[model samples]
Target: MWSGAAHVVDAMEKWPSSQEPTQTAYGLAHGTDLTFFEHLAGNETKAKHFSDSMTFMQSAPELRHDFVHEYDWSRHARGTVVDVGGSKGAIALKLAENYPNMKIIVQDRAEIITHGPRYANTNIEFQAHDLFTPQPVKGADVYFLRWILHDWPAR
Candidate 1:
């Protein structure tokens, strides 16, 4: 996607206002109607890469060092955690590994959820949900929403 930086810059030339347009940089850069997630959901290989990337990124301590060390997740050891818009339960899996007593539910698009492990009868669960719609899971101890603002900044 970085290779199309110049193309996105050229597209910006058409509009130099402070207003937030409906079009995104990725959309303009690739000249496509679908967004990045949409494109990935339609392609199995790309979607796998997106989920794998999320998992691999967690290997970097700097990425979630604060969250793991700063936050006292032990407080919710026996509680439930709903990872809204979680991509293939990467973060959910990590949380479950630390707190085996806690139930971590990972929610995302059906296409993405399919790639996740079955996780049957375990602390880790999977659910297909649209983040834009009303959340089905209620009364959760914690609702984790990491890296969601960039995608749904307004809604």
Candidate 2:
């Protein structure tokens, strides 16, 4: 089925006539007020596919290695880091492996949290959070926004 591909096609076709382009072509095509993640709440299969796709893309060894090595995550050792929209805690687990002392809270939609990953690392945790809402966890040492922000408008 080209259902997913259809969304892409629809986006391209509707881009020119969209009322508020800031909402994005996909948003316009779907005509929904809900943010991309919020819409997933009502569709478990789509939600899983989306979250799993994100996990798969982000789990690439080279990408993880670059992120882990390029930056010095050790500076925030023993501190709390909130991984926003961190589906399945893939990066959080990797970060935990290298920086075991840092407490990591991997947050995503409730749908994602329900199927979050399991790990032996005590420092890493999975949490259900909607980023569109006010952030519940305050004053974290670091707020890691991996593969999440690009989906929204700059404004």
Candidate 3:
């Protein structure tokens, strides 16, 4: 697996495949490039792949420090937070640990949350949802959307 990743990295160095392969292929074949969201929207798996990748990416210990100390979570005590597109409830669990009094909703696709732990505690709840539709949970003091914007190009 490591060797395969190295080969991919070497290939990527030669050509930036990681930056929207569909767009690059479209450009090479038709002399026109579509936006990232356009490419993602066309393929249903794009959203799932992107979300899972994000969940895996956040597993690195270094990433924890970046967000943990970056904000003052104490202000949100006794408040409710809804984590949109939250996979595996990692961030929601962290928030629950930080602010025990606050309530949390870990919202993601049913396929992603399938056979996974719903939430870390009683203060948290997991709901399978499609964010493309109207947001189901409301009145949240904070709607956590960590690293979600980069998944889609700005319209």
Give me the candidate number with maximum lDDT: 1
lDDT of 2 at 37: 61
- In model 2, the runs with Cα more than 4 Å from the true position are 1-4, 7-10, 17-35, 61-65
Instruction: Kindly indicate the candidate among 2 and 3 with the higher TM-score.
Output: 2
Selected candidate, larger TM-score, 1 vs 3: 1
Prediction RMSDs, each to the true structure: 2.4, 3.3, 6.4
Clashing pairs in 1: none
Error of 2 at 127 (Å): 1.5
lDDT of each residue in 25-142, candidate 2, tens digit only: 3455456756556667777987888878777877676654468887888888889999998888878877888888999999888889997677873798888888989999999999
Error of 2 at 131 (Å): 1.0
State TM-scores per candidate.
Answer: 0.84, 0.79, 0.63
Tens digits of lDDT, candidate 1, 1-155 = 45347666665775564234345566677676576788677889978877887777778877754565578999999999999888877777678878999988899988889887775556998999988799899999999899876665453
Which prediction has the highest TM-score against the true structure?
A: 1
The 10-residue segment of model 2 with minimum total lDDT is 17-26
Q: Candidate 3 versus the native: TM-score? A: 0.63
Prediction 2 TM-score vs. true: 0.79
In lDDT terms, how accurate is model 2? 0.76
In candidate 1, which residue ranges exceed 4 Å CA deviation? 3-6, 15-22, 119-121
